[model samples]
Target: FPRRRRRQAQAPLSPAMATPRRVPTILFASSVAAEQDETFVHSLGLNGLLELIAADASFAPYEQTLFAESALQYSRRMQTAEQNGKLDRRVEGFLNLLSAHFLSQAAQKALEYLLRHFRVHRHNSASLLRCILPYHGTRAFVRVAQLLRGSEQRGAWLRDGAGRLTAPPPRELVVGRAAKDTELLGQLTYLGAAHRVAASFSAVALLEIASRMRFTDAEAPLLRSLLEHAREGIASETAPDRRLVGMMLIT
Candidate 1:
């Protein structure tokens, strides 16, 4: 076979003509998030916010961060309303939303964020606590108690040694607490702290928590361990309702 001369090798392409290389696109972080779908868009603005909050909004553990932002926004709106002298339905919605977040992973963060408003609208903040205290159970009680007493135990976030919160304390909140209600609030606060520390929460502390806020027509349970320690201070009132109970507590 006749040997054929090999074709000359092609020279490497220059950068200008280098097969039009694709440039890598880099995305920089921005304070504003990229826009999402219309559903998301519809979920913004005062009306949208109210629509979402009209119902009890609950978030999963993973969605707690988003929950925190939403709750904060609602709180700010309430502050604006309070300033304007218009305590409206929006306020109540915020409370309901806040209560739902308590059960989320952001419970601690939610409380911390809540305490942030203590200084601004203290009465409302207290109302906020009063509303959530009844419905959220032990987790809520322990946190509010810790904040009230300024618990700085391990894992207690947003807490300092002084117990000075970003906001105020836990009484005179819901229902326009009268001077009569002071003792009950104190008892509740202690009960909550005791629960946080099992050693601190003795049989005596348990009895205090059992102190009924509302008086029931039904007979009280006896045998305080076979009729020994009697549960006292059961007040006859009402059962309730907030980031703060939904504006139902608005004074």
Candidate 2:
């Protein structure tokens, strides 16, 4: 009779009641919010944040906010160089990184922001020019030209950096060496926006660019305009080397 005592049957585990399920909960909302603080976000680095937003559509809402904050932080870094004489390598590297990451419309905006807020020295301006020239082409050049037109410091930078600026003229001109030839006659029509900047800016360096200006059927009007500006600039320019000026006037 003792052996026959019925054992209580164990309740079968149902799917809903399986092994006391862990009730999912946000342990601390404040802790989660703290993780998203600006300091914390900035620590992620500009590249990291941009990559996260770019890679995940879910993060799209934060794109503009992140970019604005990044720019503000960048502005603080640039302020010192703006007040001081030169931009050190650290600032230059940061600008280069910024240009490298944002190469689209965003890049154009950033470039404009730089022109507006910061004092662009020769090195920094060259870095920016290099960034914009290859990718954005004439439009970008025009924007830079507009910014550099009136500023004496920037104009000087352009003049000094003219040789370095030669890289971005059009493909045809580069291939033909038209701008490099003795007469400077071929590939005239293919001149990019950088040439326009040279024309707008009246500096001794303009002579270097002016000398390379070739007359062509397509670019005849442009040549005429440049000639007018060059002639005007030559009048005001002290110690203008006639040799360089003469070459510019030849065409």
Candidate 3:
């Protein structure tokens, strides 16, 4: 009876005063239990995350790792190795974590790691550039574009200090672009999975990559090709395809 009065006298919870918290979205088949995931992230840190990733072939670990925030020290191991612009094979697992619904600390860490080391090791990171765009959907403008821009800005410079400046051999070109580009954007728009969703997603990604490398002042083949796709997508029976075209127009 006395305890009941004391409990009732305590301050009521104020909606305005409560702290905001992250609401997790399902990214995999199922998520680990809340308490278990919290322990995984805060107790074991990033090493725990890597272990979970290695253990699960499915992307189930992302629920606990990508959306969960860890202290900065957990990332120390990645720091020393990446400091030298080299990454270990085991560390490459972070690539799977990049396909996030919204950019969280975990996603941001993976992004920064990739961009920071992209200049030194392009082949490893560049191979997956096309896949990154579709996962982010409209956020491709922010995440994928930022990644491409940073990689190009940091690595695309032609260095020739001795006055004998020569172009990098053809092998150095970004994926989907070439020394003398053949223009893959047109082909990519219609060449992927037959389903409208998959085709549209892949097409949008290729368009972004191709658009990035296009001549600054000169744009023709791509322009005409783009109009064709836009015309087709806008008139498609699929609502999602039409929506994709609308996003493409503004982007």
Candidate 4:
């Protein structure tokens, strides 16, 4: 009867005091666990942000090195599978995008370099001169025309204090319209024949050099004959039979 009474008394204490203690301890442990989880998630997000910054061009090499070191240090402390997976995906995507951007810039630079070489140095010629002539204004064209005319009359001039002075005399300076046309035709014929020869030689030279340079077919055609008379003048330089042979071979 005494043991039963003591057991009943202890049972009342257990229900009241022990239950409250267990409840508070469980709640405190849960609150601590939740705070730790929040901290871990926050740290993972911060690491991802840092990785994005490192992948950008604005970061210097030294700064990137420091960021990498810090990231490695922080990553070692990460314990959750979910946090690690999220971080890996974010880092991989950022790196892939960054690599593509750099590759695009490199490709653009290479293309520009090739174009500049082809335009400026490789294709410099009188045809290039003529193509650009229209852009130089009407006054520039007129000036060039006057210079060419003066060059034609150069034999009729004498060296004077003011350079060449007309020696044909004022009376002999007949402004014959027909004479002007004849002189212009002659000059044009000469210029055309000379340009034709030059162009043919240049084309043959280009083909030979291009072959040696291992240039693609796309590049060879860009070196087209811009002058019309170049081929005719080249043909006239050789004997008729030899010229025919060369022509057949070229075709």
Candidate 5:
């Protein structure tokens, strides 16, 4: 007699897994979705993503905001579904688990790796720098300084008297290192989060980095403001341990 085939049971999908997979990675000034779709980024969850971006230091503010909004909306939708009984009770558990997994040290390492290898178009770098400045202020400051320095080394200098001595060029020049320096200086001056992150620096580090950069006379005020803000920040925060570290850095 032939034995009857054994029946197999399929594992059920968690409710979170049933949510929409596609999410816009970046939100622009026009509220348009970026061409790049981060379909799998949602698996990281909201707080998990916040941790990742905080550590990664590459996602601009708009992108970070977009990720945050998208994650929040998705989570809300899931909560609603659970309330409505459209999804299994396991969805909440899955979300909690996802957050746990992404917050692990291993997940942080993966994010760092992605940051190091990720490349954006040259034209986009300035905008990216602008976005990251508020979230990772001191690091972004150093980065912009480095860009200015590199541009200076590449001969992007404007003759101090040339513009004052004669009429300005017909159009904004975008030809050489001077143009690059000008653009970078403008970016550095306008960075939104500079004051917030200024205090993280030891006074010495701030001075040293500032002196090393080729900021023009016109940019002095911005540099001075950042330095002053940083000093004030260091003074107001009373972390004795870090204060000791700052002294060590100073020495």
Candidate 6:
């Protein structure tokens, strides 16, 4: 007779396997489906998110929502920074980065909007020039020059009581000084001395001053040079620092 065959024994399952699978299958299924639709899903890209954020009336009530979603996403990123616990310094740095980026964009948009919709009156134009005077970069100065040019184009005329004929006002009637302030140029020179500098605000300021002073095209090239230099410096810096400087330069 043949020797008795030995029976092989199977190993039992582990205790861990005995329990039901704990994943929330429904949640994962929804996420997968949502990802399939590009329009339905929110993108993290800067431009896309800015468009979404700007679409909301709150962020850009006066101007077109060119990058609303991106603005909203930036705000959310700020919140995330607040919640992050890994490094306290990282949180502050991230917050600064976000603030700088958004604020600069906002200021630019606001300036553009004003240029399109609002007429710069003598008083308001003076105030605007004051704001721009300390900051002497090309973009700002160019816009200022445009405003000043507009004023000059309109001429210094006043309507009569019957609104028939008008005559130019006396020199004292003008809102701002006729020429660019010497102090502003000095300040620009000082700021330009810095190695890592941005001049968005300076540009805006220069534009405003030029506009108020009614600077000729011949005079604007100097302001434009400052703006170009500032932009170059900003571009040369590290990514986060660039954002910070851009914001500071504009604001």
Q: Highest TM-score: which candidate? A: 2
- Worst ten in a row by lDDT for model 2: 185-194
In terms of lDDT, model 4 sits at 0.31
Give the Cα lDDT of each candidate.
0.33, 0.40, 0.41, 0.31, 0.35, 0.36
After superposition, candidate 3 runs with Cα above 4 Å error: 1-58, 61-102, 109-121, 124-218, 235-251
Q: Please, what are the lDDT tens digits per residue for candidate 2 over residues 1-251?
A: 55787889999989665654222111213334333544533333444545644644443444454334654455444467554433345445444444334445434443333443343433355454434433434544534533342233332232224423432255343223333332222122112222333222222333444555555676565466556544544563443443244346544
Q: Against the hidden true structure, what lDDT does model 5 obtain?
A: 0.35
TM-score of each prediction: 0.28, 0.30, 0.28, 0.16, 0.27, 0.23
Candidate that would win on lDDT:
3
Candidate 3 to truth, TM: 0.28
Name the lDDT of candidate 2.
Answer: 0.40
Task: Kindly give the number of clashing pairs for every candidate.
Answer: 17, 0, 0, 3, 2, 33
Error of 4 at 81 (Å): 0.8
Candidate 3 per-residue lDDT, tens place, 108-222, comes to: 4344333332321343433234334343334432333332333444223222355221432221233234212333343344433334444665555545654564554455565
* lDDT-based ranking: 3, 2, 6, 5, 1, 4
Q: What are the runs in model 2 whose C-alpha is more than 4 Å off?
A: 1-87, 121-123, 149-169, 172-251
Model 4, residue 232: displacement in angstroms?
A: 57
Clashes of 5: 2
- Backbone-clash count (model 1): 17
Clashing pairs in 4: 196-229, 196-230, 197-230
CA shift of 128, model 3, Å? 5.5
What is candidate 5's CA lDDT for residue 221?
A: 61
TM-score of 6: 0.23
Better of 3 and 5 by lDDT: 3
